[model samples]
Target: MDVQSETVPRDARHRVERTRARARYDRDTVHAILDAGMLAHVAFSVGGQPFVIPMLYARDGKTIVLHGSIASRLMDELADGVPACIGVTHLDGLVLARSHFDHSVNYRSVVVFGRARAVLDADEKASALSRFVDALIPGRAAESRAADRTELAATQVLRLAIEDASAKIRSGGVKDNPADLALPYWAGVVPMRTRYAMPQPEADLADAALPASVRRLLAADEAAA
Candidate 1:
């Protein structure tokens, strides 16, 4: 698959049936959800046993990059080109409805289906690692020390092409039946968000200031807020 493509083609596996109205197949929507999420739950099977593990990931174009210890069983299995499913979700808010059965949480989520492959090339592996750090904090890779040969050798990077994917999102106010709305219950949405606190310098650093990358990240967060 060409990872640089514009959009992911949707099929049966990528379809969202439970809440079909919230399904989104556009590339922009899928990419936005993937970019906003920092963690993913990777699911796969080995010897008929299913395994799901949480992992940090970065999206580069149409591929998702993940890394782990070279000796890890999950990494080894994924590097071998096994089929996998990657899921990411971001909680937006809690919806409180007049009826308990009508309560729900607003969220944005994405599911990707693809075959994982090991990134063996030295340059490509290094680039993927850099992307991981930058994804957490923009411009961080250039501000920090580069990974040495020994460290790179101990790590394994895997790339999964975004071939079949879909995003589902639910937003805005509570949905309640007319009869339930007349009850003496409050209904509203409690918004939620993730924020970064002020950076604390290392204990060993006597008076060192925060790095430009970190400062920039904090500034961006504040601006967004």
Candidate 2:
């Protein structure tokens, strides 16, 4: 994987014309945004009507994997190689400005455009499912029991290659106009963050201690903070 590709080719569909200064085409930037995000919005058209659905996703090298029930309309449409757009965003703060027009959010976002197809191979599908679990919490898949044949058969997994992708980021204090700076209104950023709370155990497992995998996840969160 070329994390520092000289340039990511842009097209009309994936180009970021507005706020061009914030556009990032490097693979590293795009991958970082995608990896940090917990949810993604997948958009596609069905019968000429556009639909956007939120999904849990995992990035594998240059591709993204998403899973759902086998009978889902969105999964069925995506598996047919329909063109789709996947977007993930992480809000960092609220940027308050002196004027309403200058107020905005500090965020990192990525948009990927490609055609997705179902993962039909048993081995590939199983590997993708494991990746999905591990992506949420490292080593979690190894701690849990592997999915059985019937469970695998009931799920539909789709993979979309990140052919055309771009990340846009905005940070720092408010960008109020020079004239507005003289105003008496306060202008600054209110930082926001997401953290994991203490885990609740099942009532039946009162004797069982917290799993090492979960402890590791909590430790990682603390270290990050």
Candidate 3:
């Protein structure tokens, strides 16, 4: 929860410094944003070619864990201690402008830079996977199917010790030019959100007791203001 600005990731997109804004500079805010979402884009340069792939991730204190097929080159390289960039963003709104040149979107995004390596400990891997499930649906993993030995052996799990991290957020009304304001054009912020409705159990499944964690998450997201 301590604010440590020194740990903020170095700006990757340095060209648009104006669009970048920093809030509290610490893991408190950073980890909270990460735990709230399920998707992350992990980017890395391999042989002078940069590739980005969106994957599901989970955070456990300072370690961020990712899982994928063992055949993935990106995962393989990362496990070899390759440098990587991890990004997570939450879209909040849209900026509607009179002219096409002034359109934009309001969002909260974070970019992290660090070296990643494979997690070998079985205990650590299980804990990471538990958090991954909890982040998505609270306690579904405990109540549902458990990964068997064969399944765990075939999966590749990677970990990144969070080092340099930075976050930027944009909110409120659209930032239109002062001249454009007087041009009698309609300009404003269109709020955006991720919403979920009541859960419809699987077609094959019967009326069964749902996990408390799943119910809690649905309540939370539904209650989000």
Candidate 4:
């Protein structure tokens, strides 16, 4: 693990004001959170009407890759180089405290600010699509059939470089008032996790056996558990 203590330079837009101790501007921290997440809530506007859409995305180094149908309004609008804010979050636990005011949830979240540009080149678009697949399950892209020309043409790909980003995280036990510690209420953290269950194969592919990517995914999940 490459642990970098250097943090991203913060300005008014990317700085954390409230609970500043929970804020993190390190590239490694932000990247880790983005990699762990599968969905991104993208905030943008069209003709002054604001919209926030949930999108599937993959982090490629300093850029985030997104794909959608070419006919999609959001995709078309973003491709024209509009400023956007992308957010990803993971709920880690329920923090129960002696008082309701102190009750909170342990989470890791990131916000990225950038402008997205359309990926026009065929080869670059194809590689971007592959990254999305591999991000979900390592090596799955190579095992699966590649997208055909027509399919690739119909799909729109966009890349948003990480211009400014910040991560906010909360972890560990409850923080209850010292006086409230004597209260009868139980206080602790109930950890939460997202894990993969056994894979269910399609009936048509009966007994075909699982691919190496799936097996590897399951093994990694089990090891983490």
Instruction: Please give each candidate's TM-score.
Output: 0.94, 0.95, 0.86, 0.95
Clashes per candidate, residues 3 or more apart or on different chains? 0, 0, 4, 0
Predictions in order: lDDT = 0.87, 0.89, 0.75, 0.90
* TM accuracy, model 3: 0.86
Which runs in model 3 stand beyond 4 Å of their true positions?
1-16, 20-24
Local accuracy of candidate 3 as per-residue lDDT tens digits, 156-205: 88888876666667777776766687776888888988988777878766
Candidates 1 and 2 compared: the better one by lDDT is 2
TM-score of 2: 0.95
Per-residue lDDT over 44-109 for candidate 2, one digit per residue giving the tens place of the 0 to 100 score: 999999999999999999899999999897789988999999999999999999999999999999
Candidate 3 achieves a global lDDT of 0.75
TM-score of 1: 0.94
Q: Which candidate number has the best lDDT?
A: 4
2 or 4, which is superior by TM-score?
4
100-182: candidate 4 lDDT, tens digit per residue: 99999999999998989999899999999999999889899999988889989999999998788999999999999999988
RMSD of every prediction: 1.8, 1.8, 3.0, 2.6
lDDT of 1 by residue, 23-123 (tens): 87777888999998779999999988889999999999889999999999878998888889999999999999999999999999989889889998888
